[model samples]
Target chain A: MNSLIRFIQRVSTTLLFLVLLFLSLWLYISTSYYQKAQFGRLALGLSGRLAERVSGIGQYIRMREANIGLRQENVALKNELEFLRSYITLSDDKTMRYSRLTLFDTLNYSYIMARVVNNTVNHQQNYITLNVGRCDGVEQGMGVVGHDGVVGVVLAASARYSVAISLLNTDFKVSARHRPTSTFGSLWWPGRSYTHVRLAEIPLHVALAVGDTVVTSGHSAIFPRDVPIGSIVGYEIAEGNAYSIDVRLFADFRSLDYVYVVRSADRSERLELEHNFSPNAND
Target chain B: MIKQLLRYLGLAVLLFALQLLVFNNINFHGYVAPYIYPMLLLVLPLSLKHWHLLIIGFACGLLMDVFMHTLGLHATAMLIVAYLRPFVTPSDTSRAYAPGMRMGFRWFLKYALLGILVHHTVLFILEAFTFNNLSITLLRIVLSTIASTLFILILEAMRVNGSER
Candidate 1:
C-alpha cells in the first residue's frame, strides 16, 4: 500500500499535466463550434465596442480614399438610374404593368448598410467585422456583398456588431457562372493570393476566355441574379473532368470599408417549400 | 508561494495586454505577425510543476481566443507547446533556464524557435481546418514562426540585458 502511494506521488505531476491537456483539448474541440458562436456573439457585442473605437481612428485615415470611391460609385449609380429611367420610358406599357404588380407588394431583397470595422485577407479562414449587428436586423446566414461583388455570408451577429466569414476563408464557397455562357461552377479560395480564387466544376468543353466576366449563379437565393463575382485569368482541366480556372477577384478585400447585408424577402417561403419536400432533412 | 503566484499573474496580464493591444493589430502586408504572448508561458518560473504550466497555458490561450473570437484555435496550440516545454527547454544543464539568465543566443534561438514552430503549426492548421493548399499553409506557418521567434528572442534579450545593467 505504501509502495503504491509512493508511486502515485512520483507520477502525480505527469498525470495532472495529462489531465489538464486532455481537458483543454476537449474544451478546444467542443468550443470550436459552439463557443466560437457564443463567444463571437458576446465578443462582437462587447469587444467589438473596442474594435469600433480602434476602427474609428482608422476611419479618419481612410476618409479621403473612401470619398473617392464613394464619388465614383455615385457617378456609376446615377448613370444606372438614368439608364433605367430611359429604358422604362421606352417600354412604358410592360414596365407599368410590372411595377403595378410589385409596387407596395414586397421587396425581393433589401440591403442594410454597415461599416466594416475590421477585415483580414491573410488568414486561412479570414473573417470581417461590421459595425452594425442584430440591433440593425443582421442575422446569421444572410449574404454580405461589397459594392463591386460578393463578400461572404454572415457567421454570427450580436446587438452592436457582426462577423462574416469572408470569401477568402477556406470554409466559404459561392456558386458562380461565366457571364457569356452561363456555365456555373463553385468559387473558392485556394488560400494563396488574397486577390484571387478558383472556379471549379466548370466543364472543360465550355468556352472560357481570359478576362471573361464571372457572376453569381443565382441558383441559391442568398445573392440576387447578376451580382458580379470576378473575371477569369487562367484555366486548366483538372480532376473530375472539370476546368479549374483561376479568377482575379473584382472586390479588393484589403480595402473593404463598407458593405451591404442582404435580407432576402421570400427566403422563408422557399425554405418552407424545401422543408415540406423533405420533412426529415435539415434545410 | 503566494508572492510567486502574484508575480506570474502580473506577468501574464502584461503579456496578454501587449498581445491584444499591440502585436495583434500589426499586420505586415498580410505576411507576418508576431504572437508574443507564448513567451509568457515559455518564461514562467521553471520551479512550477508541469500541471501548473499546462493550466496556465490553457487559460492564457483561451483568454486570447476570447478576445479574437477564435475560440479553440489558440488553446490547442498553446496546450501542446506547454506540455512539451519541459522536455525541450534547455540543452546545457549548467545555465538551463533561469528565465533572466543570459544564455547563449544560438541555443536560446533554437529553443524559442522550436516552441513557436510547434505552436504555429497547430494553430494555422486548425484555423484553416484543411490541408487542401499545403503550400500556402506551410508559408503561413513558416513566416509566422520566424517573426514570432525573432520577437521572443529580442524580448528575452532585452530583459536579460536590462537586469545586468
Candidate 2:
C-alpha cells in the first residue's frame, strides 16, 4: 500500500493529466452542439455497424411478424395504386388530367431504404443512427419516416452511416396540419412519452376532437405534405389564445427496424429560392 | 502557503469575471475573441506542485466552461497549458519565474506566447471538432492566439508597473 502511494505520487502529474483530459473531452463532446454532431457521426458509424450485426440476429427471429406486416402494407399500397390508376384513366378532361399530373410531377421526391441500426427514445434529445449514409445519398437535413408515419430529420451523415435527430427530441419541431380542420400548428415532443407529442399554435376556436388525424403541412422542404404525424388524443388551452393538443404518434419508435430517408429532388432549388427572396431566411 | 492560495483565488475570480463579461463578448468578425484567463495558469508560482497546478488548471477551465457553455473545451485547454507550463517557463530553480518577477522580458514573452498558443489551439480545434474547414480553423487559431497573447502581455506589463509603484 505504501509503495502504491509512492508510485502514484511519482506519476501523479501524468495520471491527473489523463484523467482530466478524458473528463473534459467527454463533457465537451456530449454537450457542445457542433462537437456533439461531429462526434456522433464518427461514433455512430462504428457503433451502428456493431448494432446492425446484432440486430441481424433479432431480425431473423422476427421475420415471420415482419413478413405479415409487409404483406398487409403491400395489399394496402396495391389498393391505393389501383384506385389512383382508375381515377387517372377515367378523367377525360385534359386540363383536369394535367393539373393532377402537375401534382405528382412537381413533388419529385425519392426515398432511400435504410435500416435503423441504433435508436433511442428516452433521452431529452434522442438520435437514431441508420445503416445508410452519404454514399447512399442520405444527406443531412433529409427527412426520415417509418412504415407508419413521420420519424425524424437527418442531422449528420458520414460515408457509411448517418445520425438523425428523432422526433422525440425536444429540439425537433415540425409543421403539422389538423386533417379534419385544416388548421396548422407546430408539432413538438414535450419529453414526456415517445408515443405522444404536443401540437402548438392551434387557435382555441378550431374544433378539435379526439382521434382527429394530423399530418405534415409540407410548408418545409424536409418533409412532404400529408405524411402522417399523429392523431389528437387530448388538448388544453395554452398560456396564450392557442390550444396545445396532445397527439398519439403512429410510428412505434420502440419497435423501429426499417426507415426511409426522403430526398426532394428540388429541395436545393426551393431552399435557394427561399433564401434569395425571404428576408428572414436563415440557414 | 495559505496567503498564496488566497492571492491566486482572488486572481482567478478577477480573471474569470473579466474573461466572461468583457473578453468573451469582444469577438471581431466572429473569428477572434481574446482569451485572457489563461494568464492565471501562466503566472502561477513556478515552485507550486505539479498536481496542484493540474487541479487548478482543471478547475479554472471547468469554471469557464460552466459560464461559457462550452463544457469541456476550456477545461481541456487549460489543463494542457498547466501541464506544459513548467516545460516552457525558465528552468532556473534559484529564482521565482512569475511573470515580470525575476524572468527577463524575452523569457516571459516566450512563456506567455507559447502558453496562450497552446491553450487557444486546443480550444478552437476542440470547439470545431472537425478538420473539414481547416483554413477557417487555422485562421481563427492564429487570429485568437495573437489577440490573447497581446492581452496577456499587456496585463503582465500592468502588473509589473503596479508592483513598482
Candidate 3:
C-alpha cells in the first residue's frame, strides 16, 4: 500500500498534466458550439468604447470623407422610403385581393452599428475584432455588412468584444446567387486575392456574365436574400465538374470601419428547416 | 535576487500586453505574427524542478489565453513544451553555465524552437478544428510554424544583445 502511494506521488505531476490537458480539450470542444464566457458581451463594450475614443482621433483626419459618405447613405435611405410609400399606395387596388401579408411577414433584417477595434485582413482564416458584444445585442453567426456589401459573420463574442470570420478568409463559405436568375452557388475565397472570391458548385448552364450581380440567397441566418455580395467577374468549367465563377467583392476590407451587424429575426425557425433539409451540414 | 525576480515578472507582463495589444493586431501576408512570450518559458532556470517549470509554463500560457479569449489553446501548448524541457536540456551543447548563470542564448534558441513549434502546431490545429480541406490545413500549419520560428529566433538574438549591454 505504501509503495503504491509512493509510485502515485512520483507520477503526480504527469497525472496532473494529463488532467489539465483533458480539461482544456473539453473546454475547447464545448466552446466551438457555445462560447459562454461573456466574450461577445465584453467585446462589444470594449470595442464601443475604443471606437468612441479612436473616432475622436480620426475625426480631424477623415472629416470631409465621413460627411460625404453619410450624406450619400442618407439620400439612399430616403429614396428607399419614398419608393416603399409609393408601392404601398399603388398596391391599394380594390380589384386586386389583399394577400394579407405585411412587411413583418418577410425576412426582417435589423442592423446594429459596430466599430472595428481589431481587424486582420491578410490571413488565411482572418478574423476581425469588433467593439460590440452580447450586451450590445451581438451574437454568434450574425452577418456584418459595410457600405458596399457582406463583410463577414460573427464567430465569437465577449462582454465588450466580438470576433468576425471575414468573408475574405479562405475558410469562409456562403450560399450566394446571381441577382436576376436567383440561381445559387457557394461563395469562397481562393486564397490568391482578397478582392476576388470563387463561386463554385454553380451548374455549367447558369447564364452568367462579367457584369452580372451576385447576392446572398437568403439561405443562411447571417444574411438576408439579395444582399449584394459581388459581381461575376469570370468563370471556367472545371476538369469534370460544375462551373467555377470568379466574383469581385464590393467591400474593400482594408478601408472598412463602421459596419452593421445584421440580426435575423427568424433565424431559429430558418435554422430548423435548414437542419431538416441538410442533416449532415449541421455537424 | 528579489529585483531580478521582479524584472522577470515585469517582462512577462510586458510581453503579454504586447501580444494582446500589438502583435495580435499585426497581420503580415496572412500568417506571420510573432509570438515572443514563449521566450519567458525558454529562459526559465534550468535548475528548477520539472514540476515548477510545468506550473510556470502553464501560468504563462493561461495569461495569453485570457486575453486572446482562447480558453486552453495556449495552456496546452505551453505544458507540452515545459514537460519536454528536461530531456532536451542536458543534451544541448552550448556554453557550460557556472552554477548561477542562465542557459546560453544558442541553447535557449534550440530549446525554445521546439516549444514554439509544438505551440504553433497545437494552435493551428485547434483553430482549424475540423477536417475540411487537407491542403489548406497543411499550408496554414507550415506557414505559421515558419513565422513563429523566425519570431523566436529574432527575440533570442535581441535578448542576448540586451544582456550584453
- After superposition of all CA atoms, the RMSD between model 2 and the true structure is 18.3
Give the candidate order by descending DockQ: 1, 3, 2
Question: Considering lDDT, which of the candidate structures 1 and 3 is the better prediction for this target?
Answer: 1
Error of 1 at B146 (Å): 1.1
Please give the lDDT score for candidate 1.
0.79
| Model 3 misplaced stretches (Cα beyond 4 Å) | A1-33, A36-108, A122-125, A139-141, A155-160, A163-165, A168-173, A188-196, A233-241, A264-283, B1-5, B69-71, B90-114, B129-165
TM-score of chain B of each: 0.88, 0.93, 0.82
- Residue pairs with clashing backbones, model 1: none
True contacts kept of 3: 0.31
Q: What is the DockQ of each candidate?
A: 0.45, 0.13, 0.34
Q: Candidate 2 lDDT (Cα, whole model)? A: 0.80
Estimate, for each residue in B1-165, the C-alpha lDDT of model 1 and write its tens digit: 898678668777777766755576566556565688998888876676667777888878887877676776788789888888889665354654354325577777887888889999998887767787777778888998998888788778877776568
Best by DockQ: 1
Query: What local lDDT does model 2 show for residue A190?
Result: 66
A1-283 in candidate 2: lDDT tens per residue?
9999878885877987899999988887766443456555655555567667766776777677667766876898899899998898799998998899898888788999998876666334557778998999998889998768899998788889888888987667889999998999999986556789999999999999999999999999999888998888999999899998999998878667778999999999998998989987764
lDDT of 1 by residue, A83-196 (tens): 866766676598685785575267478899988877776566677888888989988878899888999888788887888888988667899988999998999987777889
Report lDDT (CA) for all predictions. Answer: 0.79, 0.80, 0.70
Collision pairs in model 2:
none
Q: How do all the candidates rank in terms of TM-score, highest first?
A: 1, 3, 2
How high is the TM-score of chain A in each model?
0.88, 0.86, 0.76
Residue A259, model 2: lDDT of: 83
Residue A43 of model 1: what lDDT? 60
